[model samples]
Target: MVKFLLLALAFGLVHAYAELEGTWYTTAIAADNVDTIEEEGPLRLYVRELTCSKGCNKLGVTFYVNANGQCSKTTVTGYMQEDGKYRTQFEGDDRFKPVHATPDNIVFISQNVDRAGRTTNLIFVVGKGQPLTPEQYEKLEEFAKEQNIPTENIRNVLATDTCPE
Candidate 1:
């Protein structure tokens, strides 16, 4: 939301797919509805990697999800649309937009419509090489607030040990 220089830079360069391709770890997420991301929730995803190919027209995302105390891996390949959103099918009809990217981290705003026609909005943050910094976490919280998502809904994925290595 341009509240900080780093976040401002990230939002401006969202089209730079090169910076978004790499292994990434789940850092934090904020959702309009907490149950969608709570323990064993359908949208509780931990990203493993992001691969952008074909001049950034296609995006491959590999992630892990914990359900029934078991961690499972799922990969989804989304095609980029003219509107800069990647459309893919996963738990439902999913679409995501890269909202921010830096050398070490990236952020996405995702919308998912489940089979029951329920829509969920989520802001996901992922970091590479190392865990996210406190300042970065703060920025995420700020960004979530601007999206009308309560900062309290922000969950620190790294703080949990449910996901697999």
Candidate 2:
């Protein structure tokens, strides 16, 4: 009877913890060099996907939080659209797995190595929320027009996502 009770308790605890799965909207906030990056593009739109059984284990595409308080990414890929004029591919390796993830916030660290062997470590704390609404999208269109960034480019950026609802 004690063993059965213990098993039930374990199952309940596991169920209470939320796993990082499903599609999530992401925006890249420049930790440093914000002026240059923001002048080019103020925000980025991307997606994060996680696959885990009881919780995320191996082969998860999104971030994971280990027993310790460290956030890491299993796989990270996205695109950046700047000034509504240009779209560039952004891809990198996620170094820190997620230590804690929730609908309101996500924390992770990523280490990226460029072709030149230069390494960049990016720590991301993102807010989980819905993408821009139609009105906001239209506003961005106007902003892109004034900024000389093609509206089409902005539209493309806003359309990118992790999965279809």
Candidate 3:
């Protein structure tokens, strides 16, 4: 019975990951360190796509970053851990957790520890083509408060002119 239950649980997790795959747009990004999400900062990411393996044990993120008035595309792959978090090495060692994910929306929180041992907490809220609704913004604010990320640290990437459509 225990083995059966474990198998069921694994299936459920894999299914959830499959649903997260596809095109996505960045609505907002928040960081505990403002510099990290500022202009030309490594954490200022605008998501373009998310893909998952057949088993959902691996995840891929394709995103854009603005540097020197140019938009650069980058892809990062993450391996799923037993604890349900995805770990990747990009601009640092990053562990990402999808706090909320549905067919239309996704919210991910990540912790990044750089080579210098500087830690940064990040939150990314994304959706399809539409921007975040008011309620989503409210929830993001609550999350920022809980994570101790300053209100001013939240950025609306779509509002910026640097990134391409």
Q: Superposing all C-alpha atoms, what RMSD in Å does each candidate have to the true structure?
A: 6.3, 14.1, 2.0
The digit string of per-residue lDDT tens for model 2 on 50-155 reads 4444232232445332222333334433221232111112333223344336565454434444444545433343435545556645654554455344454432
- Cα-based lDDT for every prediction: 0.85, 0.40, 0.86
Worst 10 contiguous positions by lDDT, candidate 1 = 7-16
> Which portions of model 3 show Cα errors greater than 4 Å?
1-8, 161-165
User: In model 3, which range of ten residues has the least summed lDDT?
Assistant: 156-165
Candidate 3 local lDDT, residue 106: 92
How many steric overlaps does candidate 2 have? 10
Best by TM-score: 3
* Candidate 1 residue pairs in backbone clash: none
Angstrom error at residue 153, model 1: 0.4
Candidate 2: C-alpha lDDT? 0.40
Please provide, for model 1 over 1-165, each residue's C-alpha lDDT reduced to its tens digit, 9 standing for 90 to 100: 446988767655555787888888888888998899877788888898899888778999999998888999999999998888999998899999888887888899999999999988999888864666889888888899888899899888866636665
Against the hidden reference, what TM-scores do the models get? 0.86, 0.41, 0.89
Order the candidate numbers by lDDT, best to worst: 3, 1, 2
Highest-lDDT candidate: 3
Rank order (by TM-score, best first): 3, 1, 2
